[model samples]
Target: MNVETTVADSSLLRQRAFVAFWLARTCSSFGFQMFSVAVSWQIYSLTNSALALGMIGLMQFLPSVLLALPAGHLADQFDRRRIVICAQLIEWGALLALVLLTLFSWTDKTALWGLVFVLAVAKALEGPAMTSMLPSLVPPAILARATAANAVGGEAAVIVGPTLGGFLYVAGPDVVYSVSAAFYLLSLVLIGRIRYTRPQQPRLPASLSTLFAGIHFIRARKDVLGVISLDLFAVLLGGATALLPIFAKDILHTGPWGLGMLRGAPSIGALLVGLWLSRNKLEKNVGMIMFGSVAGFGVATLIFALSSQLWLSLLALAALGGFDMVSMVIRGSLVQLDTPDDMRGRVNAVNAIFINTSNQLGEFESGVLAAFMGAVPAAVLGGVGTLVVVGVWMVLFPHLRRRQKLENEAAQE
Candidate 1:
C-alpha cells in the first residue's frame, strides 16, 4: 500500500481564516498561561492552603460540566465566530476585574476566590466554541496537520508565558494580570478578522433530548470511546502538575524561575514532537503507538518521581510531554475524522468535559493524597495507577489495536 502523506498543502496554510484563527488562539493561550501562574501563586501566598489551590481547579471544572452541553448546543445554533468573540470579551472583563481588585488593594482571600470563579465561568463558555470551530477553518484532509499546528502554537505559548509570568511576579502580580488583560483584548480583535462561511444549523429541540444526542453518538463508536477512555484514565493518574509548587520548593530547592522551567519543559517536548509528526503520516498501527506512548509517559513520571537532580527531572518531564503529544494528536485526529460535520459541536463538547474533568480531578486527587501521605508517595502512586489503566484498556478495547488494519483494508477496497 502507498504511504498516506501528512504534509498540508501550502495553499491551505496561506488561507486567511486559518491564519487569523491560529494567531488569535496562540496569543490568547500565552496570556491565559501567564494568568494561570499568577493566580495560583497569589492564592497560595494569601491563604497558604493546598485545598484552596485545589478549589481553583474545581471551580473551573464544575462550570465546564454544567455549561459545556448548553455551550455546544449554542455553537450549533449560532454563529461560531460571534460565540468566540463574546467569550473573549467575557475573558477580558474578568481580567479587568482582577486588575481593579489589585489596584484597589483589595487583595483578600474572598476577593481572589471571586476572581477565580469568574474566570472559570468565562473558560466554560469559551472551551466548546473554540474547539467546534476548527473543522470550519480548514478542510478535512489536512485536519491532522491543522491539529499539529494548533498544538505547536499552544506549546509555544506555554514556553513563553510561564517564564514571563514568573519574572513579572517579582515586579508585582498586578503587572501579570494587566498584561493578560491586554492580550485578551488583542485576541478579540484578531478573531474578528476571520471570515468563514458559517454552516446552516440543523433544527433541533432545545431540550435535554438534544444534549443526550452527543452521548448517544459516542456510545455507538467503540473506537472513539476507547481513545477517550484511554486519555481520561491516563491523565487522571499520571498528572503531577498540581504538586509542582511542592516539588519546586522542597525537592528542587529553587524559586519561581525553577517553577517556570518545570511548567514549561513538557510543552517544549510536546512542541518538538508536534513539529515532527506534522510532516510524517501515521502509516503504522496507531493504536499500539497511542498505548505505548502513554505507557512511556507513565515511565517518565516514575523517573521524575525518583530523581533528585533537577536537570534529570526536567529531562523526564520533556519525555513525558513528547509522549503525551503523540497520544493527543492520534486521538484528536480520530475523533474529528469519525464524527459527522453536523455533530462536531456536541462531540467536541463531550470531549471537553471528559478531558477537563480528568485534569481537575487529577489535581484534586494529588492534593488530597499529598496532604495525607506525602508528595513523593502521591507522585509514585499516580504513576503506578497509570500503568494499571493501560493494562485495563488493552484488554477492554481490542478494536483500537485493529484500527490501522481496518484503515488499510478500507484503502485497498
Candidate 2:
C-alpha cells in the first residue's frame, strides 16, 4: 500500500489560529498546575490531612460530572469561542478571589475550600468548550500532529508550573495566586485572536433523552468504549499523584521543591515524547505502542513508590510521563478521527468526563488508602492494580491491537 506522507500541504504549526490557541492553552495550563499546587499545599499545611486534599480533587470532579453533559450540549449549540472566553473569565475571577483572600490574611481552610469550589466550577464549564474546539483549528490529516503538539504545550506547562509554584509558595502563596491570575488574563487576550468559525447545528430536543445521546453513541461503539474504559481503569488504579505532597514532605523529606520535581518529572518526559511524535508519523502498529506505553507507566509508578531518592523517583516519573504521552497521542488521534463533526462536542465531553473522573476517583482512592495503609504501600498497590487491569483489558479487547495495524494499513492504502 502506498501512503501519502503529506496528506495535506498546509503546515499545522504555521496556522495563526492554531498557534494562538496553542500558546494560550500552554500559558493557561501552566497557571492551572500552579493553582493546583497552591491549593493542595495550602490545604495540607492547614489540616495535615490527605482526605482534605482528596476533597479538593472531589470538589473539582463533582461539578464536571454534573455539568459536562449540559456543557457539551451548549458547546454544540453555541459559539465555542464565546463559551471558551466566558469560562476563561470565570477562571480568572476565581484566581483573583483567591489572591485577595490570601493577601488579606484570610488564608484559612474554609477560605481555601471556597476558592477550590469556585475554581472547580470554572474548570467544569471550560472543559467541554476547550476540547470541542480543537478539531476546528487543524485539518483532519494532521490531527495527530496537532494533538501531539497540544500535549507538548500542556506538558511543558506541567513541567514549569509546579516548579515555579513551589518556589513562589516558599516565598509566599499570594504571589503564586497572583501570577496565576495574570496567566488567565493573558489566555483570555490570546484567545481573542483566534478566528475559526464554529460549526452550526440544527435545534434539537433539550430533554434528558437527547442529553444522553453522547453516552449512547459511545456505548454502541465497541472500540470507543474499550479505549475509554482502558484509560479509565489504568488511570484510576495507577494514579497516586494526588498523594505526592504527602510523600514529598513526609516520606521523601524533600519539601515543596522536591514535591515540584515529583510533579514535573512526568511532564518533562511527556513533553519530549510529544515533540518527537509531532514530527514523526505513527503510521503502523500504534495499538501495541499504546498498550506497552501504559504498562510502562504502571511500572514507573511502582518504582517511584518504592524509591526514597528524589532523583530516582523523578527518573521513574519521567519514564511514566513519556510512556503515557504515547497512549495520549494514539487515543486522542483516534477520537478525533472517528467522531463525526456533529458528534465531536458530545463525544469529547464524554472523554473529558472519563479523564476527570479517573483522576478524581484515583485521588479519592489514594487518599483513603493512604489514611489506612500509608502512602507508599497504597501507591505501590495501585500501580500493581493498574498492571492487572491492563492484562484484563488486553484479554477482553484483543480487537484494539488488531485495529491498530488495520488503521495504519488503511491510511497507507
The ten-residue window of minimal lDDT in model 1 covers: 404-413
lDDT of 2 at 412: 16
User: Over the stretch 260-354, how does candidate 1's per-residue lDDT look in tens digits?
Assistant: 78877898899999998777677768888888889889988888887777898899899999999988988898887777667777888888889
Clashes of 1: 0
**Every candidate's CA RMSD:** 4.8, 4.8
Record all residue pairs in model 1 with backbone atoms less than 3 Å apart, i.e. clashing. Answer: none
Models 1 onward score TM values of 0.85, 0.83
Question: Could you tell me the TM-score of candidate 2?
Answer: 0.83
> What value of lDDT does candidate 1 attain over all alpha carbons?
0.82
Residue-by-residue lDDT tens digits, candidate 2, 231-303:
9999988878878998898878998779867877888899989999888887777777778888898999999
